[model samples]
Target: EDLWVEIQANTFKNWVNEHLRESGMQVTDFHDDFCDGTYLCALVEGLQKRPLKPSWNKRPANQHHYLENATTALNAIEADGVKLVNIGNVDIVNGNVKLIL
Candidate 1:
């Protein structure tokens, strides 16, 4: 089970790196990288190939800002027809790797 999780995590990390290559961003640790939501926003933008909602917190200093960014990313994802279930901004901010993936 742990190996399976690790494989999935690595696959996601590589996928994120692939999309974010031109942006000079990389995902080493899912928990820490996506915790602040900034990296997640970048990932979403890279995937969508466009700018996300302008409401994103470019500099998230507190939990509220982090949640805002995560919300924006999740909203964009849903707008792109991705159905997210059992996860929310708090889950992303809290570094829930399983749910975040």
Candidate 2:
């Protein structure tokens, strides 16, 4: 199961990097790369091809700021007609690998 999860996570990372190439952003590790929510926001923006409402903080300083950024990303994602069940900003900010993938 661990190996399968790793492979799935790597696939997602590759997919994110592909979409974010134009933006010059990359997802190195699904678990650690999204801890601050910067890359996650970028990925969502790339996917939506639009800016997020209530813009996210480019440079998050604390946990609260990270959560805010994640919230913006998740909300924008949902706004784009993608339903995320049982996942929230806290999960992203906390770097929950399972939920993130």
Candidate 3:
């Protein structure tokens, strides 16, 4: 039942600003008015049947490229003899979280 820290909408804006600062990515602002109204969404997925499998070091997403990345990572995780859970839907195994979503 390990869930990610659900960052407040306003605070999350500041978080990325601070973290991505050294990454050289121009993270403008995380405010609604500034971002044209966008919120954070985290997709939690793991082994559905077995559930004991460990997820990829990378994270998952519900969006386009990220979703594709999730699929690839999941496939590799599965092939590694681990189980899986849903990324968006409820996970019946391994536990997951959708924080700040």
Candidate 4:
């Protein structure tokens, strides 16, 4: 069960990375947060609900901007495909410093 959970988490993380790359958004550092299988599940489900958008900012001042833009894109993803799933209490703090899931 543990290995299966890990596999699922890794797959979800890879999907997130791929989506962020395709959208020209930098993947936010979730730090140790990735160790929590439930958190990864939540992140994946949240992202699926709203896919990341491509960056439109021509002159982002910093990496923070990229993350912000990516977040905006994620929130803007259309709600047509997979049905949205709800995971509890996932928070990104300090403007990408840490993710508490």
Candidate 5:
């Protein structure tokens, strides 16, 4: 179970990196304050369940809006025939990571 969690986390990290690259965004440390494994996992899971469709015409200006835009953009690319492995629940209990893939 422990090993599986690590594998899933790494896979999620790689997925994020790939999307960031495709979107022409700089790759940042996943452990950085801006984002982390748990957050990425959650975001990807949300995306898988219901992909975001952002209005490109009404460009967002704030940080919160920017994040939403980014998510939408990534989802758009994925919608272009890129099949991403579905990621489900990502929970941390008693300092142990639990992942559903």
Candidate 6:
């Protein structure tokens, strides 16, 4: 489905380019595909270069969530001064996530 949407966007872009030629304007091809929906085509906001405010920027719950997580992390350090100090490989076993420490 994501691929389909991107294909649609490309098709729409081509159609617009052809129309531009009719107006005596030369265009050297263009691609307009954004499956992330961060962009919109002619009728959509993306094609017009209109930016969407990130969802996280609007949701109060998400803001609270990060705040809570930060506080928890601080508390962990305060209690034990222990923390994961490295980015290491993660493995899954028996449907459980195990991290290499």
Mind giving the per-residue lDDT tens digits that candidate 2 earns over 17-87?
99989888888887777988889888888878887888888888999989899989988888778899999
Task: Give the top-scoring candidate (lDDT).
Answer: 1
TM-score of each: 0.94, 0.94, 0.28, 0.33, 0.31, 0.23
101 Cα displacement, candidate 6 (Å): 48
Evaluate residue 61 in candidate 2 and report its C-alpha lDDT on the 0 to 100 scale: 95
Clash pairs, model 5 backbone: none
Candidate 1 Cα outliers beyond 4 Å, as residue runs: none
Model 5 agreement with the true structure over 41-77: per-residue lDDT tens digits: 3354344554345443233445454355444544554
Name every residue pair that clashes in candidate 3. Answer: 46-84, 46-85, 47-83, 47-84, 47-85, 48-84, 48-85
**lDDT of each structure?**
0.89, 0.87, 0.34, 0.41, 0.42, 0.30
lDDT measured at residue 72 in model 6 versus the true structure, 0 to 100 = 35
Report the candidate with higher lDDT, 3 versus 6.
3
Deviation (Å) of 41 in candidate 1: 0.6
lDDT of 4: 0.41
Question: 1-101 in candidate 6: lDDT tens per residue?
Answer: 65765576457557655544433433232221111111112112222233222221112244344333333333333344555443211111111111211
* TM-score-based ranking: 2, 1, 4, 5, 3, 6
lDDT per residue (tens digit) for residues 1-99 in model 4: 657655655665577666555345434445443322223333444556542344234344555554454344334433335333342122331322222
Question: Mind sharing the TM-score for model 6?
Answer: 0.23
Give the poorly placed runs of model 6, Cα more than 4 Å off. 22-101
Q: Please report the TM-score between candidate 1 and the true structure.
A: 0.94
Model 3 regions more than 4 Å off: 1-7, 26-64, 70-101
1-99 per-residue lDDT for model 3 (tens digits): 223333444355466455444434433333221111111111122223232223332333334434344444445546768665434212212122232
